[model samples]
Target: MTHTTHTTRTTGHVAAPRPDVYRALLDPAAIPRWRVPAGMSCRVHTFEPHEGGAFRVSLTYDDPASTSGKSTARTDTYHGRFTRLVPDGEVVEEMEFETEDPAFQGLMTITTTLTDAPGGGTDVSVLHTGLPEAVAPADNETGMRMALDNLARLLEHPG
Candidate 1:
């Protein structure tokens, strides 16, 4: 079957405990730091880390010329609800782009799961599904990878 929408999964291991990793993912202040893509900045307008809670965020590209199918210009805004949250285990959010563009018509769910690594640390897997037709799966994977890398760094070496 031919797929029309994008879906991506990225995995990584962080040299930190699951509780620590979970806190960073759900923390309002830390969310903007690690969730942003490598060349972009994330602004959190509102965040409440609990099931049925809502959050709003905007990501702006560093290069104003850069354009994604979801955003013709610079910034892409989103508002989503926390569908599920499990302490030190998992988080699921149902999100929708805040735009009238056809590409941003559907709701997307992002799930992040955490588990203990074989030797130590924590294993994190992120799955993003229901991406619109305009978004590319490869790009999403790359961005997720970057975010995971940042999470590793942030957890292993706190400033």
Candidate 2:
């Protein structure tokens, strides 16, 4: 049988320096605050920020019946490692879902790049490749966008 995979990309501009944005992306504590999409909550099971370090996280739908989850009825759990981290420029991770379904089996790669914007702040671009067939491209893009929005909000204002 031939294997197939999909890809999704999302971009956003945050009113913060590249260093700040890069820090937030690597901080385990900050992940749950901004990496989750609307209608979902995140939990960091394990995290090690260094390159080659492992991490595990789970995203659960606020409403269990909202959609089918890969790990459970309401949660999508995944574990991966930091493949590469270039200080204030980029981050690369390789992950796979914790599931039994054949449709959700694959090694996915997430590449996040940060660059300076014309006026100010940082331009963040995220590319997700090797997505499983069951994961809709539109939904994945939307989720990534929402997460970027959340990150922007978190950095633009501090209370």
Candidate 3:
């Protein structure tokens, strides 16, 4: 068997300031609202908003027919820690999936950078490294895009 490490990078613009965007990134209460992809939900079981702080979260597919769950039949669970946090500039996390499949066992590093856009809003860039071979690059990009979209909506129109 061959070992491979995949990487994915995605960027977007949110109609919000860097501080507000940064707050949304670390706030546990805001996680479930913005960190989830479409057709799924996020449940943050454990969260600590600081460097070296650990967090555990589960994403459950809304449709029972979805078979893409890495941890269980319909849920993808992972636990990791905040390796680095740079105020309103960046957030870095190291995480891995809870799965019995050998193809999905590995540590993934996610680095999210926030900056001011040229025109307006905040420029968000997310880089994912060390993705497992079982996860398609297209799927990962799609999920990240969806999550970014969700974050934008939450920050731009907070009711």
- Report the number of the highest-lDDT candidate: 3
- Model 1: which ten-residue window has the lowest total lDDT? 64-73
User: Each model's TM-score?
Assistant: 0.93, 0.97, 0.97
Q: In candidate 2, what residue range of length 10 has the lowest lDDT sum?
A: 64-73
Off by over 4 Å in 3: none
Q: For model 3, what is the alpha-carbon lDDT of residue 84?
A: 99
lDDT for each residue of candidate 3 in 17-99, tens digit (9 for 90 to 100):
99999999999999999999999999999999899999999999999898889999899999999999999999999999999
User: Candidate 1 clashing pairs?
Assistant: none
Stretches off by above 4 angstroms in model 1 are: 1-3, 69-72
Model 1 agreement with the true structure over 40-96: per-residue lDDT tens digits: 898899999999999998899888778662544788888999999999999999998
Residue 79 of model 2, lDDT score = 97
The lDDT values for all models are: 0.89, 0.95, 0.96
Model 3: lDDT equals 0.96
Ranking, TM-score, top scorer first:
3, 2, 1
